[model samples]
Target: MSEGAATAATVATAAGTAPLRERNGGQILVEQLRIQGVKRVFLVPGESYLPCIDALHDHQDAIQPIVCRQESGAGYMAEAHGKLTGEPGICFVTRGPGATNASIAVHTAYQDSTPMILFVGQVGNDFAEREAFQEIDYRRMFGQMAKWVAQIDRTERIPEFIARAFAVATSGRPGPVVLALPEDTLWGKASVPDMPRYQRARSAPAPAALDALQTLLAGARRPFLLVGGSGWTAAALRDLETFAERFDLPVGVAWRRLECFDNHHANYAGHVGWGMDDALRARIRDADLLIAVGTRMGEATTEGYTLVQSPLPRQTLVHVYPDAGELGRVFRAELPIAADVVSFAAAAAALRPAAEPAWRGLARAAHAGFLAHQQARPAPGPLNLDRAACVVRERLPRDACLTVGAGNYALFPHTYYRFQGPGTSLAPTVGSMGYGLPAAISAKLEYPQRTVVCYAGDGCFQMNLQELGVAMQYRLGIVLLVFNNGMWGTIRAHQEREFPGRTIALEFDNPDFAALVRAYRGHGEVVQSDAEFGPALERALAFAQEHSLPALIEMRYEADGIAPGQTLSGIRAAALAQRAPAAVP
Candidate 1:
């Protein structure tokens, strides 16, 4: 037979068979993962999961394993991978301490609505419930942290549990799931058929709902669009942009969800969360119609549920979410639409908007306010954060991924940098510190061509600083930007506000981060001024690109620059004035 005919015959023959084969439970689990298109698994090897690790020996070409320095770092990388790919990022860890360490990322994935699966190795089935070595009840431990948690003791049901884990993780309001594998069960032999790739179910808005939304939009004077949450595809983002532009609606994202909308878009308003713009907050509070899409309007986004009052909002609220349970769980919406964000956006894009929206000027004003606030003013001290932020904005790639942990220093990039599109900014909305560096590593590993920058505070950087080894080992280029202010800036700022100079345990001495990265055989530099930052960043980026290794640049600043607009001394003065005796009353 000719080459074409021979190829067709081979395909026909292969399709006729089930491709089933006898294998150990561990091998069968690996085969199922391979079938699901998993490219990598982040892990810290332990003895309990040796069989699975051994099974991985034969599939090196199929799935690459990322050996991390710690379980938290590994889990963070996995969570970041999930956020970037919209797939269930896989992570494996041993029981007890390993599981506890990984819980940080599990909670992050849960709160951030990212899809991830954490497979924890458990004690052998023979040691069940006897408080054996490194044994912990995973179901009880991870019940609140994970979307679903279960232990698989039966070798025959490996495929079933793994498939269901993926389904539960990627389904409604995508989040993390946990599966525990007993050592003995993983070593047992089993013959199981692999599951096909899981597909997420997309729910679209009803025609009546769309009509009602249109009616609400047509009559509104000041309408604002709040978009957030995960599970957004590129096409969905495009649809969202189209809907916003067509309706001349001002768009604001919830908390750290700047990735939900292009910050450069004409309709883009400021982020609505902690350290949010006062003008944007006013706009959100005063809007006649508020359309919340995808987001849960969590505490941060809602300003502790003060922006949109609970039970009943001051403005007419239209809430849309993927999970039906979350629609009216908090604030009762005027129109609650339980549909996938992407599907709803696609359907909303098809609606015809009013030829002359009454609130066109309101959208323009909102966008103008956002643009105005992005221009950072001169800050105190020699190392001006405003200038540094401006340098990053002007020098870095528009689509470069910027990750940040919780700190007052984050306000600079949060206000100054403009995210060009979705999935470019990875920040922890739940205020998880030390997420930036690990997330940057994962971003680079997933998209090697894209530039990944981690903006971390002195305290935040040290939280997962050991992950630099992981980057070096894998040859992934990522830039670490450390903002060294010589204290816990956010806590200090709050202390200054509340106690008026009673700063106690907030201050601490930090190591030379530049020297720290250099100790790891990575490029390092110190930038003392605004002019020094550009050259240092350029050198770091060039070094990372040329060597395919991690780079760190430490920018030194004073403690008085607690935040962009407020100084520590100013806060103290205000507090003291508030406490001063009122004419011996």
Candidate 2:
């Protein structure tokens, strides 16, 4: 197991296949990744994972290792890769602190249903149970969040475990997996054969289920289609859209999954999440038959389960999901189909209504309502976010990719921007802040041709702002829009609604963000008013493209304007009016 050149051998695995190669565990793991066509890996280097880092050096041509600022940033980047490609995004971090820091992304991936694999460098076997330096039982730490969690115990078992990780990550409810690499096993050497690349498995609806769905649709006067979740192919999305069009069905993209369907289509209903219009909410609530595809109809999409009741929904629910466990986990469905999105969409597309849908006008009305909701509204500030968002929608290409972290500013993108379809947008369903920048970096690296825009609030942007250095080093031309309201905007709005003018620990002063980006050798600017926003954004976009660097625009608006058409003063006044007089108490 010396650092010398590895030797090749002809030993075969149980199944008998390729010739075995003698190399360290690190080399075997990395080779398996390369064989699986892994082109990129995100990592925050640590001594714990030095062996794997060295192995990555030899395979530089086949795999690109991106060194990020922090483990969380690396994890976020990896998670974004998973969302964009529908493959297991690879991330490497150290044990203990590193693994703990990256847990947020793991949680996000688990909830978002994105396929990702996080590899943590662990202490050697000899140090087991002795509380070695930076030692942690990742299985115990990540068991609840990750789909699967285990450690590599020996060099010879590397291929077996690696193969399983990929399969587990991409299976049924595609999710995150954690594999801890003990240092002793990683540095040890053995002659072992690599496992074959893993194949993804999917479930399809039964013929009877298809017939049942059509029968239900035939008897319904109003039917609505809801779509979201991971493992969606462009062709599958096309099929789903065709199914909706053929059925004249109003379709609501679930929660932050705005990219699940074309926003401009006539059958396109409004986004089914926070800030959704009343008409769209009514459509989801009042529809006689609710056909949910892919999405779980999580709390956010269901508005805390008021729109679609759980256990027993008011509407006739036809839930289509890949995992059988999720079929009846919550809401009771009239027809529960266990099928992947692609499979269900393909079959659903071929179905013809028994008669013309009774609600063609319903679909058209929903789309019209969605379009009308996008119009700009007056706010209390000179810097209106709706206007700025409209400018971005008009300027950027239709296929541009937009990423957003959590904050009140998220409403702007979720409400205003028109996502072309799947792969055109990235946002956390679990509401994780600090995701926009890292996700944008991953998107820019993956596509390179399309425009990538990241929208974040002041608080959200600062969470992993250090990752801006990674974008600069990689020369990714990404346009970042920071909505700087000089406070934790979302929290401040909540405080105003509940406590009404009694706010604390919410407001904070900010550094000159433009100056910070300029220090990284990237373009930066600030816009203080509506008139300045368009010009600043134009310059930032041009500079990023021309210089092959990141460009950041800081839009500083009135702190009074927490969200679109909602001001702190207005919220406070309304709260005060609703409260009983202090004298009565």
Candidate 3:
């Protein structure tokens, strides 16, 4: 026996008649996860890792295993968990097809800067190079998509690999890590000590950097504060709030990062991203200084990198990020501070602002623009998304978590919904559809006390609707609002603009969404008109709470209601006018 095994045996023997327990790599892996304070794991069951599932059975009381219908849904749930808890979300899947299916969530984690760990069961070591059943090189497949990828060939190394996985996943510029486990190795016996919980190294801005930032802020006439990315704690958000208020800085959240700041704050500017308000774009364009905190200022956040010029932005840019490597990678920064969000915010809060600048008028104007843009416009159809957003904002609890997948339907919540605080919004920055339902499930599981709502489009919801079974099985009380326009609204809107009445493969004869939910033994409702939404939402919320199961509400709208302040017909007309032949003269 190995020395580690002998020592474990001796300890067991000393406990008077307690038999020495022989453990496999699977058992060790689960135990290590428990030691790392992982309370849950999302997974899709497979025979490739039967031993892991069996081991999970023993640790069910300590670590709840949520079985999802599809690997993609499981991965999305894990990603959402990571976003909410600031730890590596855990997901397990089988080899080949399962791993490929779960890659979407891995990509989302990479782009969104959320920490996650994906474990894939592999073929036996003997079959690895033979291209045997369900065999694939995970390292090559996930090389560009993940921060780190490795395969464990020995049972004894499980502890070391798992500990490193957690550390790497949560470290600077957090992202997903992929670990492959061979079936035979998982079944092998080994004694290994579990590592303690992992902690990320925090970085603080240098005194010089802070002084430079203060000087810049003191001189700026119109400074804009942009906040985004993960690695945020409640304390960090509180510090950011105080920092924004102290200087009356206009704060704008990056793409889908509204939860980073309180939207109702007096200094709040509108979010900067796709479908952003024109007024907010003007503010970004006219700003004399832009202080970006924790955000990478990626393509989406920068409106295809057009809002701020590349290499040298038109405005002076002060960029703060946890990773030094990310600093000045895209847009050149006049002052770069390599500090974590919380640390930088705390340091910035210490600086005394030069007597309230005469430029406070610009900040107030930005806030006014944000408020004006949030006011919903009248819809021509009975099913008005504007009204729905308002009703949800008024009805849902202030701390309720709202999740959305990609679609024009998401614009309503993005524009009108008020997130009272951090950790309240979970939307994919990568524009992945079908993310909302799984994320909502994970959010509800993480915070059962808070209400959870998922806003999905007809096409978006169907992408992972199979996960409803997971919700029903786990008894998660999440409310789903499906905007049913019988078409891929965003795609159709684009086609109308570009093709000018040439539409193809955009419409769908969808399943009865409400009936589909009911088939899963959950409550379902159909709201066809504006007046029906409030009562339907109340019923859905009450049903979710009473049954402890997900409730679905299918909201029907006319095809012309493509998006806020835009319609399919209007787009087609404008496109035709642009393409029409001019008179000879």
Candidate 4:
């Protein structure tokens, strides 16, 4: 798209006026963002950003600023937006403490390859050495975590730099970029030259590469594909499945992949990590050919980064990612292709490969074994996390979006729920709390038609429950299911298992979540016993559907010190023995 056409028509409107009126740099920044196709900007209100807030309010129609409860939640919400739409999500916060507050989500976005632009309002331009209130060198503070970190000290550079920030954020190796704008500069008057939007060029595989890939697929005794990240769209997923089926290849999703394919598909071998059965783990070791797309093969999926050392030596690993760095960064790859996921898959789909029925059969058997294992060890009573996850999965609308919070409790949905479409589930691979509520809000904001459900533990939910008001304010019909297990279940379990009788700050309590939800003018319901689980979910969904607002469902299960990291069911049963009944009012 031409630079002029890339930006919206407002620039043209501004230019046609013979009488030019200079506006605040902040307003110019908002206009530039709006022209660049930013539909929403998530933020936490702060004194330092008053000028930017005013400017945003002035241009509210062109760009919407979503007020979040916490700065971190705002960043997560932005990251989720970017995950949903293949665009750079925008998050604005104040300097120093505000930037620090949002650091976790920024790191989450960085690690997950979720494109986001975090604009932090800094101290006055002349106050750097003064150690003023909330003043800190943001570039230094956020340098390590962000892809690119810069401070905007001059008003004239706002438009061009910000436009570049968006481009860098959404480009290869997509990640969160930081822009620290000084408060004084934001209020300064400047005429920003019209900046246009930018779109990345799609990549295509070379004919030689395609030929090699096809030959490898045809000759391999056991070929497999691993899907990861939210880079693929539904159409791309379909094409991938078609290509896999044509070659009769097995498929396993990377750990916490957003959505790759239907788990019920006969050839699905299950996720690579997060406690898969021995059969699937063995399949990874034995597979002769492995083709990975849009995945980093991060530590979690690599069996705690042991793919190189332990039981699995490694196979012919082929990686395709938009980022060149991720190609061979993790597990060394036999063939690494740098290209956009959908385009690369499309290119691969055009190639022809010989069918391997034996490979297909092995894949089918592995899937069958995994399914049987799951069926035998069903989630049990006292509000079984696995069973509850299954129930939630059943209750979710077709193609519903799921957002998982941090903590062992989040493993409930991460392990149990199967996402059939791309971008259906969002969770921070970094495993940070306070991600769910904001992510849900962002999902709902982006895809209003789809049901967005957030799964959070009590400890995690408390980290950002205030976003409930943001949901209500936006009239976002998202459902929040809080796994209210009292204390920090994950840490407690660690204490119980590793250092028994040494629980310290992990033991803490909270206000009644249901009542708190009502106080925020949203619906709240408590599920005190196992019997109320199903009913509570139904009512929560109904309330969201009826009111067109967020609903909080606090399912009070016995924490029992069961940590999500425990791989065995026996561990969970043993953990349950340590519970003391605590009911939510």
Candidate 3 per-residue lDDT over residues 1-585, each given as its tens digit:
677788877886787746455689899889889989899999998988888889988998899999899999999999999999999999999999999999999999999999999999999998879999989999999999999999999998888999999989988889999999999889999765567877788899999999899899889988999999988888888888888888888999999998998888888888888888898998888899999999999898998898988878999999999899999889899999999898998888777786887577676778888888777787778888888898999899889999999999998998899886666999999999999999999999999988999999999999999999988998988999999999888999898899988999988798899999998889899998988999999999999999999999999888797778888898999999999999898
For model 1, what is the C-alpha lDDT against the true structure?
0.89
lDDT of 4 by residue, 167-200 (tens): 8887777888998888888887764466888766
Question: Clashes in each model (backbone N, CA, C under 3 Å)?
Answer: 0, 0, 0, 0
Over the stretch 1-585, how does candidate 2's per-residue lDDT look in tens digits? 333323334224344666555788889899999987799999999888787899999999999999999999999999999999998999999999999999999999999999999999999999988899999999899999999999999888899998999999988999999999999899998887678989999899999999999999889998999999988888998898889988899999999999899998889987897778888888888889999999999999999988999889999999999899999999999999999998999998898887878776888988888998888878877888989999999999999999999998999888889998867999999999999999999999999988999999999999999999899999999999999888888888888889987999987899999999999999888898899998898898898888879999999888887776778899899999889576755
Q: What lDDT score belongs to each candidate, Candidate 1 first?
A: 0.89, 0.91, 0.90, 0.77
Candidate that beats the other on lDDT, 1 or 2, i.e. the better one: 2
Instruction: Give per-model TM-scores.
Output: 0.96, 0.97, 0.96, 0.89
lDDT of predicted model 2: 0.91
For candidate 4, the lDDT comes to 0.77
Clashing residue pairs, backbone N/CA/C < 3 A, model 4: none
Error of 2 at 553 (Å): 0.7
Root-mean-square deviation of candidate 1: 4.8
Pairs that clash in candidate 2: none
Q: Write the per-residue lDDT of candidate 1 for residues 1-585, one digit (tens) a residue.
A: 434435545665699954345578789888889888899999999988888999899899989999999999999999999998889999999999999999999999999999999999999899999999989999899889899999999887888888888889988899999999999888887555668877777788899999999999999988999999998888998999899988999999888888888888889998888888789999999999999999999999998899999979999999999999998889999999999888999998897786689876777889999988877786787888887888888888887999998898888888888887666998988889889998999999888999999999999998999999999899988998998888888888888889987889877888988988888778999988778888999999999999999899999887787777879999899999999989955
